[model samples]
Target: MWSLPASFLLLLLLLLLGQAPPSRPQSLGTMKLRLVGPGSKPEEGRLEVLHQGQWGTVCDDDFALQEATVACRQLGFEAALTWAHSAKYGPGEGPIWLDNVRCAGTESSLDQCGSNGWGVSDCSHSEDVGVVCQPQRQRGYLSERVSNALGPQGRRLEEVRLKPILASAKRRSPVTEGAVEVKYEGHWRQVCDQGWTRNNSRVVCGMLGFPSEAPVDSHYYRKVWNSKMEDPKSRLKSLTKKNSFWIHRVNCLGTEPHMANCQVQVAPAQGKLRPACPGGMHTVVSCVAGPRFRPPKAKPGHKESRAEQEMKVRLRSGAQVGEGRVEVLMNRQWGTVCDHGWNLISASVVCRQLGFGSAREALFGAQLGQALGPIHLSEVRCRGYEQTLSECPSLEGSQNGCQHENDAAVRCNIPNMGFQNQVRLAGGRSPEEGVVEVQVEVNGVQRWGAVCSDHWGLNEAMVACRQLGLGFANHAIKDTWYWQGTPGAGEVVMSGVRCSGTEMALQQCQRHGPVHCSHGTGRFSAGVSCTDSAPDLVMNAQLVQETAYLEDRPLSQLYCAHEENCLSQSADHMNWPYGHRRLLRFSSQIHNLGRADFRPKTGRHSWIWHQCHRPRL
Candidate 1:
């Protein structure tokens, strides 16, 4: 006779009593899909589906672009950029609902796609599929609205829980190093390390909010457990003695986010002659903690510094400037913030301080990689109008239960400034001024390459500046040889870019026919300096009237000014500045109010004099 585990039977009995385990809400004809985990957007995330009132995931087997298209369309996107396999976006919880899903690219909903029977999957959440949808093409805030409208609700996720024993002051946090455990039927049970792999360790680490996993000392844990099991006088009984066995023989692909997402094989009922860990012991894992937020600790009777009191903030370890893990200088030391309630509102404050527009994403779980030292804040509550993070309210004494693994991060929105990502500036002290670098894709790999300076002009530089989120091009330089150690020291793949000065990106400009350069290295590459503001050439009207008059000056004196094209034709071989009717003479001075020096394109000698309009009474 076939028999299922007692826990499985209990789950079924609960369902029959109309007490289904907690689940996300459901709507007719629409299955909820969301992109979660680090570095994700609304259009991309680990794929989970609502089946039989429970939120579950699909197996990556036979998952393809076609399957992704259905998911994207359902979420109001036009198409998908790509699909990911093996829980790339982090593992999902609940049952591995669907397996061997085969979509024909024309299915309106994933339920209509052919698949294996529901809840009968031979796969686990470690094989969970993910999709990256194409960016929204709709105008206004429709994309944001659609994403919110389709967000998951009533979500009850399973987690890889940890219990600490003999914690050390220096390396300990609430959810850091401890015995790895999972919950079943409302009781916690430890996993045996008999066949545990590093892949299993990776999943557990991610579930705890660490970006990646590190090597764990299983031997030390084994020795500790062996000592406890051998001690008869010890009051601590083995977990097997408690009749609690949640998971056994976990097998993972190293990318799952939670332990419930891993594959498990049940063991036979325990007996006096048999033990849960007959020859092995419970699994113990020590994950590298990310950044931590610690409360401000001041010396006895000392006050906080003015800078520290005012709540200054900064970002670090981002791919580009003005984006990364958020940190605040508190108590004269930089510390990280917790992600307990991190959202776009709190992220906006950090972005504004960094001179960016707003927060693009409020990344959590040490998304940008963990930072070192104490964490200073947690449960940050902001209304999106605060000037700084310190001004936001946080839960009192919330850092007690927070862990470094749950560090918060952010990606701020740089003002688009009519620019593209393919172009970048380097060599200057700031991001606004630097040698021009273009990203070139070769053999499916992107490499930053230099643009040949030959024929490079202001028009081309304008596009580069706007693309870099800088305001305007101040100087378009042909040779940056004077500047030391150019950025992107890569190969020169393009030359002679011709821009119309209104182009949004350098790629939109016309490329020169061939490459020619006396200096070949990127150090001598073309560069540009951009500024937020530009100077205007204003006419000094007051000075103009005071300097010159119709006094019939000598042609010799006027000849120099005339030769230089600084005067009207009345001084052209005339005996003197006389009998020049309707000719108004005045000296004009131009003052530049911009950041750079101003130079007139046309000489003064080319000036044409004309009579001013006046009303005759």
Candidate 2:
């Protein structure tokens, strides 16, 4: 062997010791940074930075929109619309590597901004930052003519804005519903309602961050406009009626990300002509606000304690409210728990902590989906009655033999429908099975009434079953006269209620709006019988051990072994049947595992008898 230099010998020694080469640290500098968390799109999530071959979150202490814009631009986005403090996307773990970051709004990357130095932070991970980047509008379909006509400022699709109209004292915060306005040709314009439909309303509502469209009361708009014109101090007559519209004749399927994505005949062509409406009506919309639009408030005079802050938890990637990958916030950082030793007892604690019911199913192996974070707890053990997951025993360490793919998840038992008074099943033995009733406002009072059975069937009954938290529809009654005479029986409130058996509630089903039925329409009142269990017959296991025994054939066929009268005095009168054959005989107890009660099909006096001998004493 040839003699080597000291540096070469040292490198060889490191390699033999299972250590990476000097180039390993260089690769960490080029590691990819990404946004990770629950979001409807890629541009929104908790702010996480990749450093030293690990991903970490930024502390939200003093995190501002300027810093958010810098982060978004680093990720190749235009700008940030909003920055969330207090971990709106939930906290993160691994390392809260940045804190008290201050950006000048034009920095190229987060690294260039002022911060408390790498891996140094006074704040906890509960304050991890989140950002929602402004969505990039589509300018693909515009022709050269249209593009040129729009000029530089309007080159992109016109923006949509909502102007608040404080019409009544009932209006409050979070500002859900507003007047629809579109920015066109560098100016805001109101939409004309010539051909406005509910689908069109939905697109506008979605743009305004609302969940769905509500029935717009057009009469209210008429009243407001008339009131304005009738104002004595108002400059109504002298002012021009030449208000221009940005776009009209909108045709949307109600799934567009923005109003610009909808089919609309846009500006310059319409701007040149005097503004006019075919229906002479301005578009007004009412939107049903979603959960996010509601602001959270702390309890009166009760600040959150340190213990309360330490025990926060959340669920992510679930289709509904109460099912998803379980994330626990520990020591200010959010991380997942491993599925090892995880069970319904552990999962139920998580569900209850999140304000949901017990766990419907405790899923293992990351069934909901793998999360991108550290597995903070492993081999979690919990009693079935723990209040929070913090009360459970767990092995603490990110390196515990668990991966993101092995993250635990839970499907929690959630309530059926949100609009409780809108639909209900009534007058049955159990709360789950009953006549269909809905609360409707008559005159100025709320009254519970029946649903029309005109188009009602098993499909519609399925919706009722789901709304009532019943398993499924066992039967749908076309006529409820049998239960109509009961107390609180009333008129029909809905007609032609049809469903596809997949709606979360009966209110989501199709109907001819809300209808009123006169009293005595018993034949058209809807009713439902729901079942909590499947139709199954189970033999009593304990009875089989004692009073019951197995019976085999030939002699088994000579008498009905299921009847108690078998092996009676009639056996001596019978001719010797085919030569005696080996047989097993036993008494059994059959239990019905179904929604309906158990009843014998035949009378006790009608039991069949045949030749069979009782065991001799």
Candidate 3:
């Protein structure tokens, strides 16, 4: 054996001399990868290598199961396999640097593919990351699908018969044992018990494991049949008594053995043995007697009872003798009155209708309140007599006043007959005429003036002044006053005139005169200075147009197309003293007017129009 130092030295020399250690596999590229295709479930897909910075296809030359499994795992697939082919799954024309990739099945990604500690690839472009995944199963192992696939044909079911099973039994089983008697076809039949509970009797019978029948309540049979046997006499209570009667015969079916097929025998009323009666029947039965003689007709007077009289009294008041009565207007029909809204007028009218004295005071809103009945009168018109309140048309909103002012306080002198029952008319003062005036001015100059009777109201004065072609100088004239100066000397007469100091001139002062007599002074003293003058003609005109693209160009260019015609017309027709003319154009050109690009911007096209005006020019 060699010494440890000598052996280590020999090993070091050999490693350095020339036998190189095995190389480790390296990833062909460092880049991210993704999948793309139709049916390429997000949970599974083939892999493409992102090498050098660009995505490229991998060749399948050395594609193996381990590589495919890694790619599938990246796409959320737990178990996967790789398939490499020249078929059209992926682009087969790109660089396939990954060749013969050998990966430990445990590697997380294709980049981890390595052999002998060194990365290697034998994959061709055709192998470009193709993979198939075992997707997670959505349904449980023994789900409906499994059941459907297995089918009921292979399973056996216990059969039950419904013929003898109780209708009320639950859960029937084929393996049950017992003796069950059921009512069927009107008879009780005995049967063998299967897996039958009271609730499932029907299903068990339907399954042929047991037979079921309509269940009869034991209590019901006791009450209906057993009771009859125990108390035979009580059962005959509903039967009619007779000397003898025929009895019904019935077949003794399996369910009802008590009944039998026998003809009923009934004897004649007086010649047969009588059966004992039932418990409800006594030896002597009681019955209601038949109706007797007809009821008497209602007496004529009885038909009109005191209640009717009270009702009538309650409905009518006799204050106006008989004029007051409650009357209802309903369905456009009138009958003997029902009282409502009946007061003085109502009573007065009713009293009058009854030919009673004048209605001194018709009272309502009292203790004897409203009554109900048919309305006899719809509308009543009373001339203080011979009419019911309902007949009086003017009762509503009619005002009547008596001049008995001091009568309430009078205690002597026959009460002075204090204007009682007398109507008086309301009074007021009449409107009187005042004063009026007319003044004129021209070109801001005082021209003429006049004063007229207050009879010449403002409206009339306005018309008269306008007819006279007088521009109003002053409208200060109110009521008529006295005239005190010569004609054209600015003095006028008017009546009922009252003024403080707002007068335009003393020339409009009142003249001293007798009552109702008046005159006017001034150039217009005779009246307004009537003259015919034609209104001066004046002209002012403008032309405008609506256009598009206004924001990109000047308005001048918008109107430039017609600018020459506009200028020519302006110079020739609207120049100087004749008239004024202006042109306006709206367009998008304005948008570009101040911009460096100052070019006409293209926009929607439109047209232009002109507005011309001549004012008495």
Q: Tens digit of lDDT per residue, candidate 2, span 1-617? A: 88899999998998899763422112232334567775334467898887876799989887889999988766656789999888889889889877878888987667767676677777787888999886442322221212211322234454555555655512554344556677655776767677788878865664444545679677877787567767866553223254455566778666443455456764344335554554355577776654322333531121333323555777755534456778877766677888888876577677656545445456666655566546788888886446578778889746566887677887664432244446776666766666788776667788777788877898888667756656567788877766643456467667777786655556556776547444336655888887643333567655656764454445435544434544545555555554334454556666543323445557878665333434433
What lDDT would candidate 3 get against the real structure?
0.32
Model 1 C-alpha lDDT per residue in residues 255-310, reported as the tens digit of each score: 33234335675545566445666676667766554222112143111133332345
- Model 2 is weakest, by summed lDDT over 10 consecutive residues, at 140-149
- Off-target runs (Cα >4 Å) in candidate 2 are 1-161, 184-187, 226-242, 267-271, 276-279, 291-617
For residues 55-102, what per-residue lDDT tens digits would candidate 3 score against the true structure? 556555556777777766544356664554553465545555455566
Which residue pairs show collisions in model 2? 551-584, 551-585, 552-584
Give the winner by TM-score.
Answer: 1
Count of backbone collisions within predicted model 3: 116
TM-score of 3: 0.18
- Compared to the true structure, candidate 2 yields what TM-score? 0.29
Is candidate 2 or 3 superior in lDDT? Answer: 2
lDDT of 3 at 574: 33
